[model samples]
Target: MAKRDYYEVLGLGKDASADDIKKSYRKLARQYHPDVNKEADAESKFKEVKEAYDVLSDDGKRSTYDRFGHVDPNQGMGGGGGAQDFGGFGDIFDMFFGGGGGRRDPNAPQRGNDLQYTMTVEFKEAVFGKETEITIPRTETCDTCHGNGAKPGTKPESCSVCKGSGQQEVVQNTPFGRMVNRRACTNCSGTGRVIKEKCGTCHGAGKVKRQRKINIRIPAGVDDGAQIRMSGEGEGGLRGGPAGDLYIVIRVKSHEFFEREGDDIYCEVPLTFVQATLGDEIEIPTLTEKVKLKVPAGTQTGTYFRLKGKGVPKLRGYGQGDQHVKVTIVTPTNLTDEQKELLRQFGGLSSDTSNEQEHHESIFERMKKAFRGE
Candidate 1:
């Protein structure tokens, strides 16, 4: 069957952004996955969406697609390039899913896989910065073989199948004409060389699994889910390639008294009914110390007070963020008879209608303006 336009397959416009293409592909992949959908054509549809995403997600390929509606210009003709000619889909799957086949380098040493370790920190530790030590299990170079797959006395030999070309070509007949397709040499797995005598320690793989302890310092004001990348701390490189990176994902534990907003801290302060009505000075807890905040007379519930420079220090700035304290008036649930008598007398003297009138006027005026489209 003929192929459909990539944009149409992805349900996207011609000018869809890169992020849009990725989002669309993720949605489609999830919906059409064989594990998720047991329909007959789910696998084929999944492959189509993956193919479309493979082209549209790339800037260079998307430009080519935009200029020439389809990537296969010579479709149905023998001269058209096949799926193997396009960029390798395995690499795309590796980038997104991080698995399938192991990526190996022929010239350089093979590097180890990157590692991720989640570290939970107290709110203060996240705000003030702290150094932490963690141990991670990773692959390292074999000590006995020294990263070479050949035995100590014997060395690797050139692959006889492809004669060190690292590739093999196969000729096939197409509609246009006979064409030759090149693929990685199976004999040497595209490495151009083969190990005659395998190493005992690494079993000819040139790597060993080991545990490594690393120290990582987290900066101040790092929010939850912040990643700290440590270069060359991951798995050992194969052959002699550079080591991969280790990412420390930060997770901040929720504080008992405070919540974070960007760099600032927020907390709710409970105020007694008498304090909210008569006004008073109260001591509030901050990250460092307690500070006194003045409560205005007739302070209502949900009133906010700002404590300057009492929040978390900015990670990349000089000044610290302010702490916002929301005042919540706590009414007495159980009152003594004498207290109830005093409250009743106070309520009788209060001008509740005056307060209601002001509130009603403000709300009605806004509603009238909104209704009139003003």
Candidate 2:
């Protein structure tokens, strides 16, 4: 069969730079590397890409290929050229393809798994930051053999299955020709190392389970379900990898008198009839301190008053939110004889105060406007 053009295979022009050739080869190889891309033609495409990079990467081969206009060794079978023949091209293909064998250390230490701890904070604490401690069940590096999973003074040995490569190369004879697949060695569990003298404390496992107490500073304005990550505070890694991260999932307990919406705080302030009609200055409890709220005369129920800069602070910015206080008028339930007589006299003077017909008309107008989507 005729061979494809080396330059066309890599999607590069004849004048492409060395760096350009390398970058394109890396992308194409990683994409169609066979073990990564399991398509039937992935092996052939990978081979084509490797062949292109082999010739274009070398200065002398690139000159020869340009002058002779040939990339296939079988096409121009002569070895009349002096020094640079096909001697170094195999190494170029090996580097471009990242080789067919996995050589990563299976026994190499890796980062520990990420851990999560759910903590419940009071509503006030969530609004105003607090420092607290939590106990978590996690794993840490074993004391005996120092995470090698071996007995004291004894270290793990290289795995014989993959010859300490941590990867086993399996060759498959398929219709597409011989395909090589590298996988983690089953005997070593991909660590490329095996321990014969197991640690008595951790029982061959690199980690030991225990309860740990961690102190964390919960920042203000952190809402419920917010996660705070603590670096290098998770389980210890196998062999000797870096520790993973610890995530704190916050659960803020709901306050009886206050409710939060985003950064704003909301609460209902109850007012008596005398306070609402005659007006009064009342002290309301905020997140930090109590502030005086003045109710004007004729202040109706459901009236909202905003206390600026009293709500929760912004988690990511500078300004704070406002606290919205809504008033709810309370009616007197019990009345004495003298009070009943005074109320009757007051009702006689304020006869037009109970204008039900006009209130009905206002409600009907609102309903009509709502139906019209006004």
Candidate 3:
């Protein structure tokens, strides 16, 4: 079987850019992967397209491919022959797949991982805001070694395996020709250095486990599951890298009387039957203190009253939210005999069918219709 043109295999024009070639190859690879597509000959077709893309996607190899169709006369380009001697494929793999063994720069500092800590705050603390201290276990730079991982009088030495390159090259036989790839050196694990004498405290790990105390200032109106970030307070990085961030996740404890919804607070206020029949001023609980609430005369059960600016303050803006008090008129649960006789006399004086200035007719009419299946 003869080889197909690289452009034709990837379904692209001869003038297609390297990025275009990569995009085409990624789509085809996903569509024809052996794990995804179990059809016969799918693997072979995928390999053929991959090889074509691998060559034409690189600038040097594409130059050679343009000169000789599917065969680079200068560098042996034919299948099973001399076409696969190009070394630029490593760059292509690194660019496209982020693989093919690139080493981390030993001189460069890396950022550490972010850590999360759950904190419990009282309802009042969440509403009014408070500053509290919390302790977290994290990795810190070794005080004894100063993050060098070296002993008292000795220092780390360059790796002998990779000769300070931090990478090892390996040659493999491919369908086109022999290919060389770079991999991370196993001996030094790509650091390009080895610790000769271990630090006694850190044990040559360069970091020590320690508990960190961090103080966080929680803002007002913070609800449950709120997150606050403390920068550079997490685990210390390796090789003298920068420290990570610490995130405090807030969990507001349940309040005894109030429930929060956004900035508003809701609570059920109990009222006596006489207070509901006649107007009265009642004391209700607020996040800060008790406040007087007005109950209108003839107020029905489940009546809601709002007190402006009595709720939590807005976290990001000005002004406060209102508090909603739901009134529940309670009937006398346990009545004494004298109390019952007084109630019976009061009932005798009041007419059974009396409307009482039509104030109580609405509730009675609604109940009558409801019982009649209206």
Candidate 4:
């Protein structure tokens, strides 16, 4: 079968940018990789995508392909070339597997892996901030050999098989074409050095695991999912490289009454029905202290009041956020007989005075009118 246009195969147009071509190839490669996608034709589709990317990603190859539109590489398109001139598949594999495409010195410094610790803090503590210490187990450079993996008095020798390059090239003639790839040397296990006398403390690994104590100061107003980075606090590096960083991920526990959004705080306050009808001053709890809040006369349930500077401190800026207080009226229950009679009289008086107080509408009267459809 005639192969589809390279652009069409990757679901891209002819005018697609180099970045667009790479992104599309990566997406399709993951989608059709034989190990990941078990469909019958996935392998073929993956090869097709790979071929398109190999041609389009290189400027010289792309220009020739654009001009000639698929000339036999063996016939030499105005130049002596064949499948041997195609881009190396090692680069494609490296995109996913993190293998080095070119030669590299094994003794080069390599940074250590970063570490993350999830810290659960109390809600108030997150708002107020705290300083504490923690213990973590991590790898550190061996003190005896000083990261050389050899005894104090001895040193390592270069690998004879790979000649200290740490990698070996392999040429394979497959159905697709001739391909050259690099793999770790078997003699020295890619370290490029052989240790005759290993370090007693680290056992030739050049690193040892140990429990480390670290001090951490969590800033005020840190919310859930916030991360604090501590430099040079991660696992020890390899070959005298700098250590990686440590990240503390914060998780804030929910407060019993208060809730936070951004830097602002929200809470519900309960008010008696009588207090809602007749205004009263009540103490409300804040992050710092209790403050007096005046409930206006004839206040309704679910009414919100703002208390300035009573919420969490701004994490990045100077000022604090306001706290929103929502009042909910609570009804009285299990009244005494005398109190019940007084309530009944009060309802009657309210109905009688409805005309005098034009704004006041008795609950019973409203219900009666609703039932009568008046």
Best by lDDT: 4
Q: In angstroms, how far off is 297's CA in candidate 1?
A: 1.9
- What is the Cα-based TM-score of model 1? 0.67
Tens digit per residue, CA lDDT, model 2, 1-374: 88888899999999999999999999999999854675889989999999889879977667657765654433322345432222223233333355423233565668899898889999989988899888899999997767888899888898989888776766655444554555678999877888898999998897999999999999989999887889999999876789998988899999999999999999998888778878999999998899999999978667789999999989889989999999877666788999889977865665565776653454336435544556
Best-fitting candidate, scored by TM-score: 4
Q: What local lDDT does model 4 show for residue 49?
A: 93
Tens digits of per-residue lDDT for model 3, 1-374 = 88888788899998898789899999999888654675888889899889998778766567656864553334433465444444344443443356544334764666778899999999989999998888889989888887878897888888999887777777777764555666677988877788989999999888899988888899988889877878899888776788998878889999878999999999997788689878899999888888988888988777789999999999989999999998876667689999989877766655555577554444446435544556
How much does each candidate deviate from the true structure in C-alpha RMSD?
A: 11.3, 12.6, 12.1, 10.6
The positional error of residue 52 in candidate 1, measured at the CA in angstroms, is 15
Q: Candidate 2, which segments miss by more than 4 Å at Cα?
A: 1-104, 167-186, 317-319, 337-341, 352-374
Model 4 misplaced stretches (Cα beyond 4 Å): 1-88, 91-101, 169-181, 352-374
lDDT of 2: 0.80
Task: Estimate TM-scores for all models.
Answer: 0.67, 0.64, 0.67, 0.70
**lDDT digits (tens) for residues 228-262 of candidate 1:** 88888888787777788887889999999999999
TM-score of 2: 0.64
Candidates 1 and 2: which is better by TM-score? 1
On a 0 to 100 scale, what is the lDDT of residue 137 in model 1? 86
Ranking by lDDT: 4, 2, 3, 1
Is candidate 1 or 2 superior in lDDT?
2
